[model samples]
Structure formats: structure tokens, C-alpha cells
Target: MKTFYKYAAFAAASLAGLCACSSDDDAAETGSGLQAVAQPQIIVSDLTTSGFTLRWEAVDDAGSYVYTFDGGSETPTTDCRLEFNSLERQKEYVVAVKACPRDPAEYTESPFTYIHVLTDDLEQLPQPKITLGSAYASKTVISWTEVPEAELYEFSVDGGEAATTRNRTVILSKLDKGRTYSFSVRAMTSDATRFTNSEAAQLSFVTSDADVPPLVIAPTTIISDAVAFDIYASSDETYYYEILPATTFAKYSPEELMTAFQTYIVEYAKKQGISLQLAMASMLKSGTQSLQMTGLTPELSYVIFAFGMDLRGNITSNLSSTQFKTTADGYSAGPNYGGSDWFTQRFYISNAYLAMTGYGWTNSVWTHWKGDDVTDVRYRTLTTKLFNQVFPDPYDRQAVAAFLKDPNYGLQFNPALLSATVNSADGYNGLTEGVSAGTSYTLLTLATSSSGAETVCVNSVTTKTSTEAAAWFAAAA
Candidate 1:
């Protein structure tokens, strides 16, 4: 009976222990359910040219909220707001916030919130650096380094936006005669912010005087008949051409020429305080001779005298004289062929034929009747017939035109006709082969008429017999 009592007591102890463990678990669950977590809201405020401030609503149930600027290290702010300074210009920044729970056992954070900041400070733009290159009388080219984050450059001639752009350089042109002008520059970063204007960079340039000589084309001598030298004025300003005296060309030694050029350039530069490089000279050409410049000014009239100078300092007197007006505005010469008579005649003939035939000749050869192609068989036949009718013939323009337009002939007739010489041993003997001779005879008959045509026929026959005899003798020998 005692042993049975002992077993019952042990069972009761085990049951109590299990009940205690279950109660402890229930209590823990209830405690966890009572604890609360907090969420934080971020807001951006006080946007300024320098920087921006950020603020947030703190969560009541949270232990602390951490804020970060642009994904940087987190910082703790009790009032949920902080002021950040010295922000970059025209740049975007993100502020992030996260809430942390107070309970050590139940540590959890709310979702992160973001705030953006922008600054409008212009000091962040790069400083302007100016470079002056290639200055001439009445004009100067100025280049500058580009400013970072700048949308457009504000250029001032004297002090204005008359010339402004992203282009680092601009050409200043058209200044008063013998007067100088100053230039300055600045940059615009954004629609709202513009950097302080840079100090004025002085580029003074004077307009060339009326007496200043124009630029001369290089190598002086234009040897190629196909290429004509350009006579460009230093500027787009109005200028005229005048014939320099023949004596001037002969009297001016190399040193004199150099001195003259340098003196003029220096005078122009000193007036403007800017460098000037001679660009080119303007001259008029007539026949094979050219007239040197005599005078140049706006809307001025001048006479040009043609003259030549030998390297030995011998000058040819003025060969001819012509007058021209200085154009009101700058002008460029049109392409010219130097007036080659033969070339001009050839061009005229080509153009006239093209107008008549509706097709231009290609490289001196008629396009429609070219090469050995059979497509021009009609042309060949026409030409042959025409040549046959014209050989041993007198000159007849109408007959020649008719023969050319005839549908049965080609260019082969040209060679045949050219080969027909009365002084030759063959005379008109070979002219009878194919239509060449026949056309020559017909042309001769038409040109001389009746009795004259009959006489020509007899002469042609006699010439043919003589040619045959000559050929036989030569072959026999």
C-alpha cells in the first residue's frame, strides 16, 4: 500500500511542473502584444540659395528616429529637424528617415521616407578664362573656356548681350573707321541663377583707314590659267580698287614693300591696340595684264591702269586703263576661266549645240553619237551620207547644217573630209569610199550649182585618176 502512494505523489509533481510552463508562455505572449512601434514622416523645408533644412514628424511609440542626408551616415535629431548648409548648386539631394522601436526585445523600424533639396547658387559655376587669337583691323576673334553647368554665355561688346551663347568664342566685326571697341563676358547657370559678371577683357580694334592697302594673294604670280587668285579685303567693310603707278611697282624694292606693309599694319594696329594680319589684295584683270590697286574707300570711284614689272626692276608703262566703283558692301569674285579664246569658243559651241539638241556634249564628244555602239547606227549612216555629198565641196554653211542634222550620218565623216586634200596624191580619190565621197560630191554640186558644179565634178574625177596612178606607182616601187 505504501509503494502505491509513492507512485501517485510522483505523478502529481510532474503535472504541476507542466502547468507552470504553460502559464509562463501565455504571460510572455500577452506582454509582446501590449508593446507598440512608431513610424516617422520626413519633410523638406527652407529651400534657399545656400542650402535647405529638413524636418520630420516623430513617432510617439518609437524610441528614436534616425535621419540621413543623401544616403550618408545616420544622425539622431530629437526635434526631428536639422539644418544642412553649403549644398551644391543645381543639384538634387535626398533626405531619408527611419523610426526605431524603444523595446530592446521588440526592436523594429518603420519604412524610410525621403525629402529632396535644391540650391540656386551661381558661385559653383567655373570662372571664365578668355583667349584672344587672330586680330585684324576692324575685327577680332575672341575665345574663352566654357563655364561648367552654364546654360548660355552672356557676351558684351562694351557692355551688353549683343553676342551671347554656349560658344566660347565670337568674332567681333564692323567697327568704326580708326576707332576701337572693348569686349566683356559672363555666364548664366540656370533660369534663376547667374554668376557675377567677369571683368571686362579689353580687345580694342580700329577700323582700317581708306589709304590702307588691301591684302595681296600669296605667291603673287598666278601661273595657272585655270585658277584665278582671290582678292579678299581685310574686313567686310567697303573698299575700292585703283591702279598703282607702273613706276611704283618698279621703284618699290623688297625692303620698301616690307616697310610699306609693316607701316600700314602697325598704324592700323596702334589705332586699335590690336594685332592685324593682312588677309588678301583685290585687283582687276583685263586680257593678260592686271591693274594694281590705286585707292580704296567706301563708295569710291577709281581708275585701274594695267602694267607689268620685270624682276630686274624694269617697269612697263600702263598698257590700258579701266574704271570701277568700290562696292558698298564686301563682294567675292565669281569663278572665271581667264578668257582663254579657244576654250571660250569651245564652250560657246558646246552650249549652242546643247541648246539645239537638248543634250550637252560630254568632254568635247557628242553624247548621242559616241563610241562604237550600234545604237547610233542612224547617226553613222547620216554622217556618212552627208560626208559623201560634201566632199570636194565648196564651203556651204546651210549645207553643212543640213548634213549635220541628217539622220543618216555620223562623226566618221569628219575624219574623211579632213583627209580630202586637193594637194595630196590621192586628192579626192578616197572620198568615194562609202557615203563620205558621195556626200562630198553632193555638197560640192549644191554649193557651186549648174556649170560650176559640172566643173567641180570634172576636176574631182581627174584628181581621182591621178591619185590612183600615184598609189599604184608607190605600191609597185
Candidate 2:
């Protein structure tokens, strides 16, 4: 800079000598035909890591100014002030400005004025604390302690494609189940040179496992009366599930849910007349994502609740659930009362020869019914019916008594009715058939409960024309 100033002073003196000695009209001096405008004195201010502002005193008789910065092309402007932005930080820059007379024929251009500038040094950014949470079989959440003045955070998993978030957290998905993973995170600014990026933070974590997999429930499909969902787990384990009215589900916390579900398991076992151990073993499911809930009543909202259970029926995992509302009746599975889908109750009786013969709608509880206990049979009535045809009004206590006594009312009364007697020690499910296209049908079945209570379960559905069944419920996202 000293060397540049020395040369500039010499040049100024040489120009003065030439102007003083000139006698011709083209001298471009005061006494000649034209005179040059005064050179502008550049003023620099507001220097920073990225940029600065430059202003020069306006020259008298000058119509405009021209200037250049950092060895860039000169930009002509009517305003004497200029702002240089988005420059590299901690770098030296040079600015040059020259004044031009309003009338070029009478006044020539002035000598160039130059100034050197160096921007302020860049600041170092501090590292953020990384936190790993909500880890599932296929995904995990990454978050960080907010850094003061941090504009954004960059994240990468196992050296894969990078992701960014203005917020403090991000979710990393499509991970392998029961696996460990490595993650790297750093804080940054939108402008790359504003502040030095914080050093990357390294973290290692393992997602939840089978016995402890966090149940992330999602609704895969929803209709007027049923909702199908899936469960996400890390390994194979049993899970107990229950769906409650939205208000009822909202009343319980995760801990409270665990306690309530515990009571349900015991009562469920007693109702099945099986040891609690056997009931517990039968309910747990194993899969990566099989989220579904059905038999939901239309126009009703519900929250499906589920949690991990040890092989012994002890609640071993935190409560995982989601909320959804069913639409108005379209097509549905039986039991419009709530959304219980069990249209056929599995019969459970041991050691005694049992044979039942009856012509009634409530298949689960008709063996012994005193007159007027008709509604009690309803427990067996509503399930998970059918048509406009005249049928037995099971709820009509007087009507049901008369119908059950008439042998003439056999299968002829309701030819569509179905009953299955299975050893249950073995299972039966090949009741298949052919059907028509674009037609709707209602199904009714009488399932005898273990306690000799008869229940009628109903399912209504319309045949679909396209797509395979498996595609509707595929792998989890």
C-alpha cells in the first residue's frame, strides 16, 4: 500500500506539471478548451466477514461516477454511494473510482482515486450436542442442542446422502431392524463463508429391539366402518392391542395405559376360560410393519392402543398408538355397534360330548334362553348383517320364541345363514366361493361362545373390480 501511494503521488505531480506547461486548446486544463473534474475521495465503511459499503464525496460538475472493486469490472452509477455484498471473508479488496464531467465536450474525465480494503476476520462456530431418540426397527430421530445464532444443521447417516434442517431435529429412516448406526451432524449458515462451520459431531446408537421395540402405529387404510393399520417392531415378539374411543384413549397416559391393558389381559383370559399364560402367548405378533385395525363403526373416532408384552403377558414396552376417525358407512365388516371384527367366535369347550341343534339368528348363545332374556342374546348378536329380506327379529322376545319352536322354519327361513363346528384343536377356513361383479353382499354367521352364549356376527362388503389384495397393505414407509 505504501508503494502504491508513492507512485500515485508522483503521477499526480507529473500531471500537474503537464497541465501547467500546456499551451494548446486540447490540454484538458483550466485555461485550455476543457478541464477535468476533481477525483473523488473514496470512503470505506461497514466492513465484515462477507461484504462492506463504499461511498465517495461527489465531485462538483460531475454528472456521474464509475467504480471497481476487487479487480472487477467498473460499474457506472448516478449515485456516488455503492454497496459491495456477498464477498469472500478475510480477503483484501481494492476499489477505484473516477468522476466524469456533466458535459464531456467542455470537461474531461478526472484522475482515478484508489483505496485498498480488508474485510473483518470470520468467526468460529461452536459445536452442538447431538441427541439420538425415537429409535425404531427401521428409523431413528436425530436432534441437537440449539447453538446460539446457528442458522441450520446438516446431517448424514453412514456416509449416505446429506440432509439439512433449519430446526434442531431430523428423522433418519429405512434403516435395518435391530441394528446399530453411525451419524454425523454439524451446524452451518446458509451463506457458506459467514462463519466457519462447526466441527462435525459423531454419534452411535442402536434402534429398539423386539422385546422393547417402540410401537409406532400408523393407519394404512381407513373406510366408513373399519381401519386397517400396521405395527412396527424390531424383532419377533407378542403384542396386545386394544382400540378405544378417542375420548377414552385421551384420558390415559402411557403409564396409565400399561396398567389398564394389564387388567384387560387378565379379564380377556378369564372370558376365554383359558389360563392367562395361554392367552398371552396367542396375542403377540411379529413383523416389521403390519399396522391395521378393523371392525370400526362408521362416523366414529377411535385411538388404537398397543404395547409390547413379555412372553408371560407382562407389559414390557412403552405404549404406542395413533388416532383416526371412520367415515360414513360405505362398506364394512360386522358389528356396527363398535368395530369389533370377530364375526365368528371360536368355540371352546373341553371333555364333554356337546351337540347343539337350533334354528335361530344368535348362533353363540341359544342353547338355553328363558323367555324375555332376548337382549342378553345380543352380546352374541352384534358382530364384526345383511339384507332387505324379512328375517327373524331375534330381539323380539315373543317372536324369537315362536320362531325357535317351529321346525318348519329350518334353513328355509334364512338360507343365507351359516354355522361351522370345528374341533378348534385344529382350525377351519376354506369356506370360499365364486361371486358376481359389481354387486354388494351382507354376511351373517352364528358363532357359539365357550360359555354357551350365542352371538351373531355380521360383515357387509362390495366386490372390488381391480388390484390384488396384498398391494393395498404393503411394506411400511
Candidate 3:
């Protein structure tokens, strides 16, 4: 079986050689028992930029044949068809196919077949150039340069469906305000071929008018560490503030004034939160007397000012009188009083005496009462005597308690009263060294000073008001 198979393969090889030699037209002279004729013919049926397929009529008794393709050396094809890969774009390719019969007895030369494949010439359209025009009101217009081979131009705004048109420009209307729009254009060929989109041209426009002025609400006065006035404003427009130093009067626009007032009130409120309102009220009521109101809760400083404005747009500046602060309830000694200690001591003694003789007193001789002694006749007599001597009345104890809780009472002497002097070198020079009449005192002294000569002369002495002085003194004690 192996020998027979080898013989069959040898016969097939001989027939294939005969077919190749026969196509060269000199097989008969070579004495190889084969006749040479023309190369097998190949007709190209389909051609593209990538490859081409060649088909030809089959030869009789042909086992296989070889053919040349696209100027390449001859290559064999067993099926009488040749496919040339890697063809150039828009170029022509020459192709041929040969066949050989497998039966040696029937093998003969067959005519050569020839075919040429030509790739179609495709002209790519140039990129379209887009130009976005300015937008007005509710409309925006866009224009673009036309592409030479473009069958249709495509236009789109912000990735929306593209509008097809042959014209170089298109107008889009009914755009929303404050919305941004992007325009793009592309060119397409007649055969449904599309080129890359052109460089996108973009222009953004906002549809808001800047002609309106912001609205201003009424002004408000914040009585605090500093007299701050607040004004409220409302509008779509942006606003800024201008702080007026002394009064609500301002040359700035209403918006500016409102902003300034608002800022002042906020700051003043923060400073006055810890201060006693009574103290502030008293200072203001001093009526132009240079009263130094100081020793306030350092965190909360009081301010003296008149009226403020309400939301009604009416200015209440003159309508409401300026408010002042008085001493706290526990420290309510009159301004002339130095400090609360004198008053507090008196109250304390009075309260102690009342407690001894009040309704709950057990003995009059001040001796401790034993278990059964509470009902003894001697204990009862002593209790009555003590009650009459000490309490005498319940009102006295109530008054003392009330005095202790007075808001005007301060632990320290009011620094506001003492005249302030920046320098205090000499004991007496007819001029106090440091004295300030404002809420706080500062001492000042000229440089000239000697030990015993009294060269340290003080001038411009200021003192705290009576109310402030009393408050400071009480608080210090």
C-alpha cells in the first residue's frame, strides 16, 4: 500500500510539471514529454484597496499551475484561482492563473488567461471650517466654509441633532437665557461618505440685562459697644457698603448706606452681648456730661445711640430717644455712692439679725436648745426676746437679698470715675499727672521731672462720669 501511494504521488508531480512547462511555449523542445503553450489566463472579478481575486476557465487534465501577480514572481495555485494581497490603492494589478491535469495520459497545453484589476479612485473631502456668529436675543447664527466635494453640510448646536443643509450658514433661534451653546459643522460626500468634523467654533453669550438697580430695605440701628446702624437690601444686582463714621447721613447711594448699616449693627451686637443693658442706658442718659462708662464686661461693651429704621422704609432716627444703662440691680447705689461694700455690709448685717429673730428662732439667750428644751418655758421666753431684737420684721431680710442681686453692683471700683493721668511723677504740682474724662482713663506726662522739684506737671485730665465711677467702684469692691 505504501509503494502504491508513492507511485501515485510521483505521477501527480509529473503531471504538475507538464502543466507548468506547457505554459512557457517551449515544453516540446525540452524533450520532457510535455508541450509548452501559453500561460493560463486570469480574470480579476473583484478589486479593492486591500486585495483582488482572479478567476479563469479551468484547463483540461491540469493538476495545478502557477501564475505571477502584481509584478511578483510566479506562485502556484491548486484551484485555478489567485488572490493578490496587499494591493495599492487606486493602482492596477496584473494577475494570471495556470492549471495542470493529474492524468498523465490526458495532459496537454492550454491557452494562458490574463486579467487586470483596477482599484476605484476615492477623493476624500476636505474638513469643513465652522465659524460661530454672535448671538442676539433668542437667536444665534453660524457660518462655515464649504468643502469642495461635500454633498451636504451638517450643523449642530451643543451635541444636538445636526441640521442638514447645502448652504454655508444656518441660523438657530429660540435659545434659553444663560445657556451656553456650541456649534459644529461637517461635510459628507454623495456616496454617503463622511469626513472628520471641522474644528469646532464656539461662542457663549448670557441673556441678562445689567440696567436694574438693587433694592434697599430700611436701616436699623444696633445699640451696642459702638453705635452701629444696619440697613437691609435685596436685589439680583451685586451691592457693596460704605461705612459712615458719625451719623446715618451719607452721600453714598442707598445700597451703599444699607450695606454699611448692616455691617455696623452686626459688629455692635457681638460686642454688646455680654454687657449689662442697664449700664449702657445710664451712660447714655448722662446727657452730654463727659461720663466715662467703663469696667463693662470686657466681652460686652455698650454703645449709646438714638433710633433706627424699620422695614416700613420709614427712618426712626428721631422718633426713638437714645437709650442708656444703669447700675445692675444688686449694685443700685446712687451714682454718688463710692462702692457697694458699704451697702452690701449694711444689708448683710441686717439680714443676719433678722434671721436670728425671725419666725424660726428657737432661743433668745443664744444657747443651743436640747431635744426637749425646745418646749421648755425658759427657751420660749428667750426665743421671743431674740426675735424682737433681731428680725423685728421680715421685710428687712427681703430688702437685703434684693440689694445683693442688683445688676448695678460690681465687685471692683468703677475705673471710669478716677481721673486718668499718663504720668504721675510728682505728688502735687497743681496739675494731675494722668486723668481722662472718657469711658477709660489714660495718663500722660511731659519728660521734665526732678526728684523734689515737682517738674512733672500733668495736663488735660479727664474723669469718668458719676454713674460710671460708682459702677466701677462697686464692681471693684
Give the best candidate by TM-score. Answer: 2
Q: How well does candidate 3 score on lDDT at residue 370? A: 12
For residues 345-428, write the lDDT of model 1, one tens digit per residue.
001112222345433222122111112111111112123223433543324435443554455542333333322332233322
Q: Each candidate's TM vs. the true structure?
A: 0.21, 0.32, 0.21
**TM-score order of candidates, best first?**
2, 3, 1
| Candidate 3 lDDT by residue in tens digits, 1-477 | 222233334434544544343344434433566653335544444343445565556665577776766557877667756666665766755554455456645455444344445543433344454444334334344555445446787767778886789876565667765566666666655542222223234444443222111221211211112222222222222222222233333234444454555455445545777333332232222111112232222223232322333332223332111222233211111111111111100000010122433311111111111111011011011111122233344234343233333444212222232122112121111222222122211111111112311111111111222221011111111
Task: For model 2, give the 10-residue run with minimal summed lDDT.
Answer: 468-477
Q: What is the C-alpha local distance difference test score of each model?
A: 0.38, 0.54, 0.35
The local lDDT score (0 to 100) that residue 32 gets in candidate 1 is 62
List candidate 2 segments past 4 Å from native. 1-213, 267-273, 289-292, 333-440, 443-477
Off by over 4 Å in 3: 1-41, 123-477
- Candidate 3 lDDT at 352 equals 19
Better of 1 and 2 by TM-score: 2
